[model samples]
Target: MLSALKRVLIGRPLKSTELGEQKLNKTKALAILSSDALSSVAYGPEQILLVLMTVGMAAFWYSIPIGIGVLLLLTALILSYRQIIYAYPQGGGAYVVSKENLGKYPGLIAGASLLVDYILTVAVSVSAGTDAITSAFPSLHAYTVPIAVVFVILLTLLNLRGVTESASVLAYPVYLFVLALFVLIGKGLYDMATGAIPQELHTPVGTPVAGIGLFLLLKAFASGSSALTGVEAISNAIPNFRKPAPVNASRTLAAMGILLAVLFSGIVLMAYEYGIAPIAEATVVSQIAEDAFGRNFMYYAIQGTTALILILAANTGYSAFPMLAVNLAKDKFIPRMFTARGDRLGYSNGIIMLGICSILLIVLFGGHTEQLIPLYAVGVFIPFTLSQSGMMRKWLREKPAGWGIKLAINTVGAAISFVVTMMFFLTKFPQVWPVLVFLPVLIWVLLGINRHYGAVGEQLGLSTGEPVEVIEGNVLILPVAGITHVVEQSLSYARSLAASQIIAVYVPFEREEEAAFRDKWSKLHPDVRLVTLHSPYRSIIQPLMKFIDVVDRKAKENHYQVTVIIPQFIPKKGWHNFLHNQTSFYIRTRLLYQKDVIVTTVPYHLKK
Candidate 1:
């Protein structure tokens, strides 16, 4: 069932070589990595205003302090993670940082945190983008979930085409967004300085609170800190950059940090100057656009830019989630399938998996950013704290040249980040604690289960120290339906196996047909053996299954192995697979359970 759903949602997996020949240069890789961080410029202001809204417009000034705090944290995180790229250029990001210094449990914590953060990145970005677009066209409001799902599907397809393709497609729009936003914010500032500014735009209504409290402060900080969610993605993509990966990666991180800080600050200052209120439904970009341009062409342009950036922000996850999953799979924390690359040389399975989960989240949350925000920051902050702590630990353990200086800065950064993270849980846990509790427990349980299974298989001395064994046998038995390409391929395969004996078994439904089949076999291969089994019940699977059991019993007595080669046809497009492969599938399943038996499949292609 999961396979069917995967096929319906993600499409067929492609080989790594099929991803195309293009490699990402540092500029393009940076753009791709920065998409998530740059995207925060659109909604980061809105998130702050969201928290402050409860306190009324009089408290909106708090956004400035919150933004500054977040910016400081962002700068520290960028610097700290830049060291991460330098230390581990192979690109494990937070996972590598925690694992190498803080040990396996911390590594797992980081992995789980990053995983959840990536998932929320997709959900929040898509929902926020959808909200922006819907604001431009009110008719789209009711179809937000559908639109988000379609967007995710399109992004998944683009990612499957290759990372370079996705980056190329998104770069132009993201750049346009940066240009448009910069222009808009610049225009707003110029008008404010020149006294040409329009009257204050009425902000969204909110419940008035008496005063600022610790809870409100923590909530504001948590909302502001979400801007840092994708800062680590650049570190993860260090390996994907051109030669001199560390130098290129660090340079890219620097550029991203400068641009993001500027953009984030500009948006917040502009929103504050315009007297824009905290909007529960609209984004800061849209609110600013509406006020600055008053629903004119420039307004639409800013709206378009913000919407595009939000959608492209998910590209950050597209770029990072697969790499993290591949890393986890390498460590045996995730299934090996996630480690496999697709035709685009990207983590195709991981991409599709994330896309599906994100779409489900969009649907479940009704594409509302506010509803999903609670589950958002905890994952990101957990990793941020742990990763910084891990780097501090590494600095202490190694005591390398200049270690003292780096350690002092990292220690301070880690301490501050850890306190903020704890505060986030305390303030947001009423809403987010459930996810924090659920995701970690779930990940640990899965890890424990995998370890238990692996340990048991190791004790049993199984192949590759894993529970599953690759079946091997010699005797070839092909279940055929007269002569076809499927039969031809099965015969060719059996010949290749070079078994001591080959048997073609068929279950005859009628007496005359059975006699004619025997006569034809007698003429075709008189020297070779042909077994005819009668199914008076006219059942295909049962007779073949019984015949295979009998063959297995006989082969064991004679000290021979049984290799069942089923001649199965590929189902035509739009045809039910169960009707075509049920017999062979049952026969193979039943035979595999028996001792000294191997199952092989020789697939025959069907014409379109």
Candidate 2:
């Protein structure tokens, strides 16, 4: 069923023999790696205000410090991750760092956190984009969830087509967003400083609390740190870059950091100058436009740009989810389904899964940016703390003369991030505790699944006790229905397995057909053994099983194993399945249960 669905969704697989291949050049590589970092410009500000709104207007002032802290964190994270790119350019990201330094459990923790973060990146970004669009056209407010779901579907389809194709389309909107944001910030700052700001521009959301304390301040900082969500994405994508990966990745990281700091700081300053309300439901970009341009064409342009950038931000998840899923699969922390590559050389199953999960989140939060904010930063910062700690271990291991400098930087980064993670967990536990509980249970389940697979492997004798070499033999047994082209192909396959004696077995359901098959086989291949088994109740599988048991007994005596080569007819159309019997499928499955019995399928193509 999964095979049929995969074919329908992603198209038929291309054989390696059928196509030429080329490697990704620097431009293509840069676009792929930069997707997540470029996406952050969308929701970073909204996340900051989301928490501040809880304590009213005075708490909004904390956004300045929060934004500054996030910028510094971003820089520290960028520098630390630069070391990761240099050390493990093959692109394991946080998972690799933790595994190499910490233990497998830490690696699993990192992997799970990364996976959740990627999915949220998709949900939050799309929901935020929908919010931006609704701000411009209030009618969209009613259809926000549906619209966001449609975007997820569209993005999934584009990714299934190919990474290069999706990246090409996304690169332009991201660049446009950066340019428009810089221009708007520059203009807003110039206007504010010259005393040319409008008199009626200010609109405060709530009154300040006179006795706000440290708890409120920490809460605000945690909210602002949400801006750092996409910082780790580049580290995860180092393997996707061109040759000399670390060099290219470092440059990309630098570019992302500079742009993010400028855009994020600019938005905060502009919001403050315009006296934009710290409403939980409001986006700073929209407020800045309303204050600076006053419902004019420029305001409309900014709204459109903001929406575009938010949608593009979701594209970050499109690139990260599949890669993270692949890493987890490698480490046996996720189901192998995530590791399966589609026809387009992308993780199609993982992409579809991410889209579905994102859609659920959008529905759960009712597409409200404010409601989803509390649940956002907890997963991201946990992984950030672990990654920095891993980097500290990495620097200690290398022990170069200049290592002390890097280690000091990473140590401070780790301590700050760790404290921030704890602060967010404490402040937001009422809302986010459910996720913390849910994630550990999910991780434990995954570990149990991997253990089960290991047990099965042991039972199957597929696991090596001491990794010794052993020789194995192959045998082929083709199940023939009648004397036709399919039967002929089966005979040919049996001949190919002549190294082990080839046998063609036929199950007789009716007397007349049984006689006919015997007569035809005698004429076709007189020397080859043609065994016939009678099905008293006209049951195909029962007769086949009895015959295989008898054959198994003979093979045991002779010390030779059996290989069942089933001749399957490939259906050209879906409805053809109803026209033919499913005997081959049942036969293959039954044969699999017999010890020392191997199965091979020789498929026959139906005529066009």
Model 2, residue 531: displacement in angstroms?
8.1
Models 1 onward score TM values of: 0.82, 0.79
Point to the candidate with the largest lDDT: 1
- TM-score, candidate number 1: 0.82
For candidate 1, the per-residue lDDT at 251 reads 91
lDDT of 2 by residue, 1-608 (tens): 88898677655676544322312444554455554555555556656666666665555666677788878887888888888888888777888888788888888888888788888888888888888899888866789899998988888877786666677777777777777788788889889789888745443434455656777777667777777788888778665565676788778777777877888888877776676774534467887877777888888887887787787677777777787888878767677888886787777788889888988888888887766656767788888888889889888887977899889888978987898888877877787886768789878987997897777767778445655433244445667877777778877767765556667788887888889989988998897778888787888788777777788767767666777888888888878988988988888888778776778888888876
Model 2 poorest ten-residue lDDT run: 16-25
Model 2 / residue 389 / CA error / Å: 1.2
lDDT of 2 at 443: 85
- N/CA/C clash count, model 1: 3
| Candidate 1 per-residue lDDT over residues 354-449, each given as its tens digit | 999898888888888877766776777777888888989998889899998788767766876787778777777676777757776868875885
